[model samples]
Target: MANGQEWWRGSVTYQIYPRSFMDADGDGIGDLKGIAQRLDHVASLGVDAIWLSPVFPSPMADMGYDVSDYTDIDPTFGTLEDFDALVDKAHALGLKVIIDQVLSHASDQHPYFTESRQSRDNPKADWFVWADPKPDGTPPNNWLAIFGGSSWEWDARRRQYYFHNFLREQPDWNFHNPEVQDYLLDCVRFWLDRGVDGFRLDTVNFYVHDQLLRDNAANPLPWAQEAVRPFEMQYTLFSKNRPENIAFLERLRALLDEYEGRTMVGEVGDSHHSIDLMGEYTSGSNRLHMAYSFELLGPDFSPKHFRSRIEAFFKGAPDGWPCWAFSNHDVPRHVGRWLEHAGDQEALAKQAAALLLSFEGSICIYQGEELGQVDTVLSFEELTDPEGINFWPEKTGRDGCRTPMIWEANAPNGGFSIANKTWLPVKPPQQARAVSAQGENSVLAFYRAMLALRRAEPDLRLGNTGFVDFPEPVLGFQRGDSLMCIYNLSPEPVTVDLPSRITPVLEQAAEVGDGSLSLGPNGFVIGRLA
Candidate 1:
């Protein structure tokens, strides 16, 4: 922090899903060359950094989360030289590059996992979580894989079962083993030498396990049918989120400290204790630079829901920092999830973007959010996400939010590719919201203005956030002492008296005169208090 390398603080990072970003070769798949070509567009958005999703060599079992090789780029994405050129292109455009690191698990096809499962006395046997089954011949415990079934997969060679928090093909690593920790840190050092500005650590909270082979206890609270998968029925106490992760995070941080200006934002995946973990993992500046959870990414939309979660995190970890986002590749677009709370599609997009950007800490804008893109509607056959395939109708999976970017409204495949069919079809709805079709008053233009304003004003970017004591349907907060941010989160107009006379700075369906203010549906006011 003393090195003045804290640009990540209060900065905005854009998450790029390379496969869906652009296809330079017209191969119906996006590659590093494609991303390099699109760097100019990303730079135009006023983002400080760009976070690329996993591009490592993989079996694609979990869609790149199942990493088979960590040190090289997957052929589907590109080669090491191509990645280096992409990095160079991004740097030229004044954008920092952040890559994803999935350390908790590796695809079973990885060389290490292949050897570990070959025999009980293999050189890498203890590198993975290997457990002996009971006399009755069942899994060691009730720990379940997040993709759907038992967490343990039997291996006939070792007469034991291996643990997997996600897809069974993705086996969990033995973090208790010192060699495993050393190897992963060395892999990180490999990237540090490659000139990456930072990292977006994936499944960071799942870095360690109980190691006792204990069962996961049932969830104490009654959730009814709201549970998206069977994985939600249990507490995940023994299966993951073990205490040992804190030490490993410290080790990781110390490694990053060696590189000037390197930062990390971990994704905490716990259901019940994610917020507390977000607080713990980021507290004291010795671990993550910032962390984010599903808190703001869900379907809930209200003053209370947003206020309660933001307040809870700061209260628990005063020194810690958090990153906020409204939509991402993993969830349905905010425009569709909160459609009931919105009167106009463009209006809601602008308001939600305003709220996210104005938050206290660093924020992330998922790809296509600035264009006011809505989720793509897909049939069950069109779904590629394993979670959606397993839960079918209950949860349509993440495919809707993960469609390719729409650069042209009328071009084939939404101008993503010239091929007859891309990896995932880009439908008409997404095409209609293309970047080529937008004008100066479009959501994309508003995003550029908002970002420029944040950069020009200090209070909006680095101010201390203090929420006002207002009731539901109305959200008001003070940024520092002079700037006031107010929002009406309902579909109906709500009128209120300002704390003082004010001048409207950024408004959408909002008006301020005298001491009275009128906010229409999804209305917002960022004004200077008089």
Candidate 2:
């Protein structure tokens, strides 16, 4: 890597979900112009980059996760010129731009899928994963989609079943086909030529499937209970996480290497093998620059859970790097998700940023986490997320998290748009936490300070993490030899030894003295190692 080539390593990336980020046209949907207009806010946070979540042309069957065109922006978002302008503006603001690349699948309406599904003998027939139905015409295998049913959906056009790990409208691409791989690479090159800094590969592990099409085995471990999604009942060994994907990643990496200072961070969605695969995908010099998993984004909030995930990643892939985030468009915001374990939402929000920023890898900050944005409470009729709609009472979907971002507290639709209706409603609770309503002591201010602190302190950014022995609900760690960080993960106060030779940082979230560190509810201390 050249000097500054590893800009993504240990950097802070602000993720932008285009549809909810901001609306420039009063059309009730966020667009590229909206994002470009908001660059100053993102740059003000000291984030090194902005990762846009799929702005490509799409039928939006999966809310932009299913791309219809590989090389152009969706009409709802903007055009190629608008995208180029957004990239230029981002670079001018000293922030890199990372676009989402959903290579695992494409919208069923994509020309490639449209052409391939027409007939088995067409030039593009093998472009997507198409298989003959079993002898009984009951579909190919027992692989289930994350959305709830069998992964195989019958295509009447070809008289066969096409595999999809997500919605049936999003068809999986056949990475086993060399031409398909070449096409995807060409799409990547198009972006690189247009000057994107990197890519956030969506569902990175689902790129390739087992060639044999064998049935997935039953999940080994008892999840302690019933799974909300039937897909969780099986291990999906054949449907995804295939070893063949590594070769494709290498090819992608090689293509990225063609451009200077470029990088790629993949989202590993595996449950059982996430860590192991995170290691394998980024372990070497010829793969992804960084990979992140759902380990930290869930409801688990404890010293044990934190220590285990971080330590496990390093132990499994010592040479690999990880990007960590507490919230994203996919999950419920951390403020609400971890409130059961760590009360005092504001304190927890600041504490979460402190803990995540102090860790030893690149960090991602979701759009409204800085504002202490909690998940929006929506009624069944107001829900828009398919997952939330599919699993209704049991699982209100990602719409709670994907609601249009709140900007001005009093502005209509929380300043997200002037239209009478936005894609998702901006509830009062969420609007109350808007940027305009925040103060100096607010979670938003704390985030700005914490992020600036990380940027200024090399140890916080480039340091290797060493877990400090601490009791439950209190997470402690040494960041390289320069800093010591300890946090109280619960609402109850706790006093513990300062681990010796540690002095409180100027921006300490709480008090410390007399060789004993006192942590209030959701309190934390980042100290310099003397």
Candidate 3:
């Protein structure tokens, strides 16, 4: 957490999924002006910065992941003037703006992709990853798409197959080509010139693949199961996480280095070698500033699981900085998913906030987490997520968590939009936890308090953490110099002998006694070492 090395260390970032954050117009889709109007609300949370999901012109194939134009703002989101105003307002509010950069691919409608597919020898023909089909007319390699099925799509116009790790309409870029690299760099420059602080690189490891197109090996783990998609069964070593990606990351980092205090966090999605890859991406000064793994976002919510994940990253890369998040656009909200074991939802939410903030790395708070929002239950007919639509009953898609933010309890569309119908239904339970309802001494209030404490208490922010010996289901760790944090992860109360050097400074739940600690279910305590 050195000051000169990485500016993102110990920073709290709030993620705003633009389409669901707030809608200014009656179109039911959230826009840049809506985000600009809400800047004060985000700043009031005491977060260090805000990370906005894609607002660039897109075909809406994967809901903005399939970008058609890199420089222009989507008309549905806002005009260029609205985006500039948002940048100005965010900076004025002392909040840094980090945009989502999906550089792995572009929409098929993009000029680069359009020209590249027109003919085999077009001027932009080599800008995309195009390969010839095998003798049997199958894909050149055995690469799998994260969405589902094969990674390559047959293009009749080009008489070949093109790589697409996600959606079929989103074509993978040819990062190995220097000209393509320069074009992507210019896109970065376009945003950097507009006063964006940094980027959250999407599918960062998928930037490059084995040029020879080797088949990926079978996953050796017996626990690996084909649950939501068949793509989860095989190891992705050959398809992505190539050795060539690191150099390109360095090149991207060098461009960002020109902007003072700018930072970047890569999304590392590999189940195998995630932490190791995270280390490799963020270890040196020339690579990404931070990277987050899906380890915490996974199903495990036990004390042992949390400890092992954090310790593994700390051990894997001593110099690398990590950013942690329990919930995001992809997964079910932590409150709803962990509710069965976490006891009272309200208390558990505070405990989660405390646990995340106390971790020895940067933290990302998903929108609606402050109010302890849980995933809204959606019927199959109401689901909008493409992945969810493809998976059906086995896995309810991300639409549960991507529901619109609730600002007023009784307002139409929870005040997210004036439209009569929303993209996703905003439930009454979620509406009850609206910002106005919880002005102070609410879950949102507790969030602000926790963030303030993390900011004020130096030991909690950038301190080295070491686990304190404790019985099962009770997690205890001591931050550097002071601050001993303990969490009760079980269904019943647990008592532990307090360290003689420590005294209770903050108790998240009143049922937990002061000084000598006795934690109820889902209880957590923050104490200062004497």
| TM-scores of the models, in the order given | 0.98, 0.98, 0.97
Please list all clashing residue pairs in model 3, or write none if there are none: 501-530
lDDT of 3 by residue, 1-530 (tens): 22443557799999999999999987898999998888899999899889999999998988899999999899999998999999999989988889999999999999889899989998999999999999999999999898888999999999999999998998999988999899999999999999998899999999997899999887777766744577888898888899999999999999999988899999998878988898889896889899977888976788798888889888988889899999999999888878877778888888889889899988999999999999998899998888989888898888998999999988988899999888888888888888888865678988888998898888888899898778888889989987889988866888877764456666764233344678888888887777
**Per-residue lDDT tens digits of candidate 2, residues 237-329?**
889999999999999999999899999999997768988988899998999999977889888888999999999999999999999999999
Cα deviation of 154, candidate 1, in Å: 0.9
Cα RMSD of predicted structure 2? 1.4
For candidate 1, what is the TM-score?
Answer: 0.98
Model 1 lDDT-worst window of ten: 1-10
Candidate 3's TM-score reads 0.97
Pairs in clash, predicted candidate 2: 388-397
List, residue by residue over 346-379, the lDDT tens digit for candidate 1: 9999999888888888889999999999888899
Predicted structure 2: lDDT: 0.90
lDDT of 2 at 22: 95
